[model samples]
Target: MMQLKWEKEGYIVSDDKTLLQMGKIEAWISGAYWAAGRSREIIEKSIQHSLCFGMYDKDGRQIGFARVITDQAVFSWIMDVIIDQEFRGKGLGKKLVECIISHPDIVHTKMGLATKDAHGLYRQFDFEMDECMRRPLL
Candidate 1:
């Protein structure tokens, strides 16, 4: 997949996986409710197989992150969306999701995501709860 980027208000969101800081991402995501106890190996594999977004500040510090599992044709499911706690309430999350959903390869695909609390945020992007069944193995 072609790497893509979006910039706004001095913050940048990029899909270049090489630009990701694994250590920081692992730390932030490991503390998240959905991904707590997730190991680096799994995270690394996820990034390798999925389309990942990393949001950075003017100085290039990563401030937010998200990834999408997609076929680039019919379906896209977003996961592990998170912003550094220090940067929340600044609209960075909105920008990050904007970049993801607006991405060229994903724009036309049906998108889905699971969020424990950020419903207001995703709803802004037209994401809504729908009837879908899942089988959990965890």
Candidate 2:
């Protein structure tokens, strides 16, 4: 099984399958999509093309999450990173992204993500937007 070790907290990140895990990840992240009124179908469809990880506290309760979509070769886009409100400000976001960024499975691909206010959070992992613009570029 694929696993990620967080030595500081001594927890393992794995492929989450339980309903509790699914619910926890969904609950913490759904609000951003909801506030934008994104449909449930979009979220579910996104999950299929992505890799997801759930972070656990010392007691092993799910507390954080992140995901990525990639072609496993040239590029990837990280998405939906969040720690519960209670879990913020403790560096868990850093740890969670650390786990995802350094995962053995995805190390070879170029990574990217879209975020509004968390630019500071992702910068620590070397994520940034390119000057390359994709549009009718006026």
Candidate 3:
């Protein structure tokens, strides 16, 4: 996979696995309402298969994350977007979403994401609610 990176001021956003802080990611997702009790192995596996973005502070400590499962042609599902508690309210979330939507590989694909909150934030990037409901696989 090609690596994608963006930097602004003192922060960095990267899709380089080398820069990811797996421990931090696991800790955050373990407490997330959508992923509570999720195991490290599962997190690792998910990262391995998905296009992951990691946000780092000036000091290079990881503070945020998001991932997309995509075919690089038609479909993409953005998932697991989170910013560390201390980093919230600083617009990093919007930056992260912007990077995902503007990414060369993802921009033209049909993107989908589910959020219990943050609908307003995503709307700023043109994300709208889908009329179709998800069907479970047996």
Residues 1-138 of candidate 1 have per-residue lDDT tens digits of: 667888778999999998999999999988999999999999999999999999999999998899999999999999999999999998888888888998998999999999889999988887878988999968
Give the alpha-carbon lDDT of every model.
0.92, 0.70, 0.92
* Model 1: lDDT to the true structure: 0.92
Where in model 1 is the C-alpha error above 4 Å? none
Model 3 CA deviation exceeding 4 Å by range: 135-138
Clashing pairs in 2: none
Error of 1 at 32 (Å): 0.5
- Using all chains and alpha carbons, the TM-scores for the candidates as numbered come to 0.96, 0.78, 0.94
Error of 2 at 30 (Å): 2.0
Encode model 3's per-residue lDDT on 1-138: one tens digit a residue.
567789997889998888899999999998998899999999999999999999999999999999999999999999999999999999999999988888888888999998898899999988898776888737
Worst 10 residues of 3 by lDDT: 129-138
Off by over 4 Å in 2: 10-12, 17-20, 33-35, 39-41, 132-138
lDDT of 3: 0.92
lDDT string, candidate 2, 7-116, tens digits: 57564555453412766665666676522444556666666667777777678888777778877677777788888889789888888888887777777789877677
Model 2: lDDT to the true structure: 0.70
